[model samples]
Target chain A: SAVISQKPSRDICQRGTSLTIQCQVDSQVTMMFWYRQQPGQSLTLIATANQGSEATYESGFVIDKFPISRPNLTFSTLTVSNMSPEDSSIYLCSVTGGSEAFFGQGTRLTVV
Target chain B: AQSVSQHNHHVILSEAASLELGCNYSYGGTVNLFWYVQYPGQHLQLLLKYFSGDPLVKGIKGFEAEFIKSKFSFNLRKPSVQWSDTAEYFCAVKPGGSYIPTFGRGTSLIVHP
Candidate 1:
């Protein structure tokens, strides 16, 4: 399993503000996945990032609302742009180890 | 593309009772199945997994699951429950030759002592 460190562990931001969450891995990985777990909802994939390439956003997500930057193999960032209360959720970072996935500690964000 | 379904959204169990959490996936090709548990405030951990060969596989902490290919189900089971078993369990499926997994909506289990 990979050791992933994500921050801010939690934050309460005002509406229309942006928050950047960082995910650092212990070792180099080819791809990193970003997920959002809304209140009482399943984990939804926000985007998939591969080093040096553009991040692939999911069906309902876009580069404007959720822009991702993957500068290297072990690091990536997801920034929530112009957030609203509806954006309140626990955002998670995950990487595949062997055939299974390992997750980060997660960032709990609250937009008010 | 693959998707997973967890029928029970929330489950309440008493200590020493048997447990079963249903997990079914939609895919016609080969797949890898897994069960993950998230204790309150803890990271999601792999409970068990099935790749091939054995249809039933055991995982850490007395958790087991059986994969029925025909039904496209991999249900989790435990002979007895403990208070410590109270957590959110998620069933995931990764199509063969792919690393990305599709996660179920998770079943939140509450075990009273």
Candidate 2:
């Protein structure tokens, strides 16, 4: 399993602000997945980032609202733009290790 | 569209009680199944996985799961439960050759000591 590190473990931001969460994996991975877990809700995939290409957003996610950047194989960043209270959730980054997926310590965001 | 379903939303059990959390996936072809557990204040960890061979697969911490192809079910089971087993369990599935996995709404298990 790859060791994943996420920065800004917890944060509080006001409405209309933007916050960027960073994920770094010890080893290079082919696919990096971003997921959101609302309070008491299931994990919903936000996007899939592959190095050197544009990120693919899920059904309800968009490029403008949740922009992603994967500059290298081991690093990816997800930015929540124009945040609102509804955007408050735990954001997690995951990578496929063999057939299993390993996740990072999630970023808990609270929008006021 | 592929989807994973976990029938139990919340389960309460006493120590040494048997556990069986039901999970079902909607897919026609070969699929990879997994069970992940998230302890309080911790990240999700893989409990067990069933890809091929041996419908019954055992994982860390004495946990296991059986994959029933005809029933389209991959249910997690444990002969006995402990306080440490109290956590949220999620079932995920990925169709063969697919990189993305669909996760079910987790089942929260609470075990009394």
Model 1's lDDT to the true fold? 0.95
Candidate 2: which pairs clash? none
Clashes of 2: 0
Q: Which residue ranges in model 2 land beyond 4 Å of their true spot? A: none
Backbone clashes in model 1, listed as residue pairs: none
Q: Model 2: per-residue lDDT, tens digit, A2-23? A: 9999988999999999999999
Provide the TM-score of chain A alone for each candidate, in the order shown: 0.98, 0.99
Question: In candidate 1, residue A104 scores what lDDT?
Answer: 91
The Cα error of candidate 2 at residue B36, in Å, is 0.5
Please give each candidate's TM-score: 0.98, 0.97
- Show the lowest summed lDDT stretch of 10 residues, model 2 chain A: A35-44
